[model samples]
Target: MEQVQQRLTELGFSTGGVDGGYGRKTVEAVQAFQATYQLEITGQVDESTWGMLFGSHEGQDIAADDPADAPTADRLVELCLHQVNDRYVLGTQADHNNPDEDEFDCAELISWACARLGVEFPSYSVSQIDASHHAGLGLSVSDAATTRGALLFRRAGHNGSKYNHVAISLGTGEETIEAMDSKHGVAVGEIGHRFTDGGYIPGIQYH
Candidate 1:
């Protein structure tokens, strides 16, 4: 565990001094690393995470130049909008885990898009405070007036409630395509106009 903690720190995730202690900081660092590498954010160093961390001799390549993990933003957005009217189900379906299911939620919708585009993304809702959530995925956009294919996130604590949401930009003025809710399975609407705690994360590919 010390070796793993050391490797994590060397990979740019600080494990709070790494004294062979798998404390909260260590877990958070591991989760951050997993988020960056598009791995399962289990917070525990699983076999897959361990392999990636120690397998690379030189260093982990967290850039898009690694052709094996490149994401095409245009293709992702195109695919996301293609399934605009699927079913919306909570806690099930619509991720790499269940690719065949038609039902989806907000986070699931984004994950489905990533799968179709051959890109890696967390299938669950990603928190804004979570570092590395968008690492290597693309650039970060701060403006509401963003380009097409931009990934949007709704931070927690809206209207005095902790509810997070995600959606894909449709480039239709200010509209976005998302698996909104049970009532609106999947549809396009003015997400920016409705949500105040929203921001844009640029797509992996520009063209």
Candidate 2:
């Protein structure tokens, strides 16, 4: 079951948890996968579904999964919101499996949200934003106000990395959630003018 969950995640379907358990979340992910491939939506990993997922069928014409408008993006935002009051801790990754361990940093919060849904993400702002864009898993939104679920980013120095820090936009033009360094652990704040760039996060949304 854990393997299935991981496979689904790799295909851009979020199972919500990677625990080796066949619960409703797993079923939902399976259903989405099946539906995507025009297979029977049994919500169960039967022979055909398994074949589609693992690439066992030779004559199939398949493309990589695009999570541009997946519903899971909103959920990822919700997961970040749940950590609103947590303390900021640098070089620490948020533990999705343990609610009690809530320490996080700017990039760590995004990493944790992805981990909760079995999605893979880097632990630093620069890497997470840049690497994904290079891999075609992330899309930039430099025009128009960032829509709901868009990723917000900023840089400190004039010649600094555009992804110096990261935040989750509330879809609203102003609101966002992020671990604003040592001073503000995890807090609900505005995506001030400093946040000059935006992105559609992988496994989240496109814009």
Candidate 3:
């Protein structure tokens, strides 16, 4: 476990000191890592994550002799994402919510996913928009046109203040993202139509 924590820390995850125990800090760090990689925020170390921390190295060693190509961070993130399901939880960093337990939100999910993808992001919903500003990565309708990796957004309530919720594009116009909500374990939703606000993030493309 200490090794795991060390590996995660070396990968840019704030593990709060490399300890063998899995504490809240470790969970937070793992969630942060998962967010960057666009993976499901489960907070629990699983097979996919192990592969991410270790398998990639093995793969590189095998490919070392081959002058063809090498694995990329984006590819690793995508692999991790596919290994997870879409579910949501509350109060837990594994779920997209205010770490303070204030509200269940999607930005947590986005932030976690982005972390796993090696992208730095703010941990709030509104901040997500601001972070994407001028970056051309804010959610948009045209994102639905693409069938592969795309970000999804949903508008809710009457006032703009009520508008909340965001998700990753699952290539089928479906609002499915690796979420962690209390009701659902880790699943996807239909953005706006079934859940609430819906749109896609541009510029920061995921493949």
Best by lDDT: 2
Give the TM-score (vs. native) of candidate 1.
0.54
Q: Which is better, 1 or 2, measured by lDDT? A: 2
Question: Residue 189: error of model 2 in Å?
Answer: 1.2
Q: Which portions of model 1 show Cα errors greater than 4 Å?
A: 1-70, 95-100, 127-145, 196-203
After the best TM-score superposition of candidate 1, give how far the Cα of residue 83 lies from its true spot, in angstroms. Answer: 1.3
Best by TM-score: 2
Q: Write the per-residue lDDT of candidate 3 for residues 1-207, one digit (tens) a residue.
A: 898888877765556688699976576556545544434556777887677677754223212342332233233234323323333444345432322222234666666555554556676665665555546544444454233445444445634535455555544454354443555433444444443323334333444
For each candidate in turn, the TM-score is: 0.54, 0.58, 0.45
* Model 2 lDDT per residue over 9-121, tens place: 76655676799998765775675455445466567889898888776662243223435434476566656655654678887867767745568989988888887767777
Compute the lDDT of residue 199 as modeled in candidate 1: 35
lDDT of 1 by residue, 1-207 (tens): 899888876765656686988876577666556544546657788888888888753255444353554576545554454454467787666546554456788887777777765655567666431322444343343333255656666656765547777777554346566777887566655654444433333335654
For candidate 3, the per-residue lDDT at 147 reads 36
Scored by Cα lDDT, where does model 3 land? 0.50
Per-residue lDDT, model 1, residue 96, is 66
In Å, residue 111's CA in model 2 sits off its true spot by 0.4
Ranking of all predicted structures according to lDDT, beginning with the best and ending with the worst: 2, 1, 3
**Model 2: clashing residue pairs?**
88-185, 148-171
- Number of clashes recorded per candidate: 0, 2, 41
